[model samples]
Target: MIGVLVTFTQNEKFDRSTLAGIASELRGPFEGMAGLRFKSFMLDEDGVQARNFYVWDDEEKGRSFFTKELVDKVTGVYGVPPTIEYLDIVGFVDNSGT
Candidate 1:
């Protein structure tokens, strides 16, 4: 699978409520996309950083979504640019005993 890690610093005066709203809007669309397996988000207000872990079925699918259109849309919502790293998962350990 392919994974994407995104890290970003929020604008100092950014509104938390707006950030929450944007995140909420994104969940549905991301979950509905083909090849998107899962996503996890982490926010550190004290550190002024946010991270997103995204798992996709393959590299192509992940790359397609990182186009200018998507970046522009995301930047518009966050009011700050993000740095993203795309990676290929060679191994994993799932301990969920379901």
Candidate 2:
């Protein structure tokens, strides 16, 4: 499995509504996408940054998704380029569902 983290930093603090819109817009493209296991939309405690954590079936899927077009889309939405990091999933624990 592959884990990907993409972070966006803004010059000024972002509002909740804006964050909601961003997350909402992203949901359509990623949810149920092939080779994508999960994605979490997040805002930093300080509210100046936003991030998306992703778990993919493999590195190929992760790389395919985080492309130049994605960078353009993110920049268009949030007005900043994202810093993307990819990692190998070592381990995890999930108990959200019964």
Candidate 3:
């Protein structure tokens, strides 16, 4: 498996409504994405940064979605260019259903 983390940093914390809007706009595009196992939207405790963590079946699957347009969109939304990192998923633990 592959893990991709795309992070955006903003000068200030995003308000609840802004965060909701971001999720609303993005949920459709991410849902059922090719080779994607799941996606998690994350926020830093300090509230200055946000990230999207995506788990994919492979590297090709992870790369297939994070395009230039997506980068531009993220920048437009957060007012900062995102930092993207890709890593191998050495292991995972899921207990959501427990």
Candidate 4:
């Protein structure tokens, strides 16, 4: 499995609520996306940051999804660039349905 962390910092020109709205609007597109296990949209209103965490079943898919084009596109949307980090997920625990 692979985990990706994408963070967008708030800037003078951008509001976090706009990003949150975008996330809400795009949630359905990601719901049944192939190779995507889960995605979480997070915001730190006090800290002035937006973070998104994605868990993917396929590492290649996870890595390939974050392309330069994607970064640029999101930068345009947020009015600031994002910092992306990729992790090799060794294990996890889930009890949501249990």
Off by over 4 Å in 3: none
**Best lDDT goes to which candidate?**
2
Looking at model 2, residue 43 earns an lDDT score of: 91
Residue pairs that clash (backbone atoms under 3 angstroms), model 2: none
Q: How far does residue 27 in candidate 3 sit from its true spot (Å)?
A: 0.5
* Model 1 vs. true fold: TM: 0.80
Q: Which number leads on TM-score? A: 2
Clashes of each: 0, 0, 0, 0
The list of candidate 2 runs beyond 4 A from truth reads none
Which stretches of candidate 4 lie above 4 Å from their native place?
Answer: 11-16
lDDT of 3 by residue, 1-98 (tens): 99999998889886656866788887997787778888988788888888888999978879877899989988998778999999889999878879
Looking at model 1, report the run of 10 residues with the lowest lDDT sum: 10-19
Better of 1 and 2 by lDDT: 2
Indicate the TM-score of model 2: 0.91
Q: Per-residue lDDT tens digits of candidate 2, residues 29-66?
A: 77689999899999999998898899998889888888
> Which residue pairs overlap in candidate 4's backbone?
none
Candidate 4 per-residue lDDT, tens place, 1-98, comes to 99999988865434656866988887998989999999998877565778889999999999999999999998887767999999999998878779
Better of 1 and 3 by lDDT: 3
Error of 3 at 93 (Å): 1.8
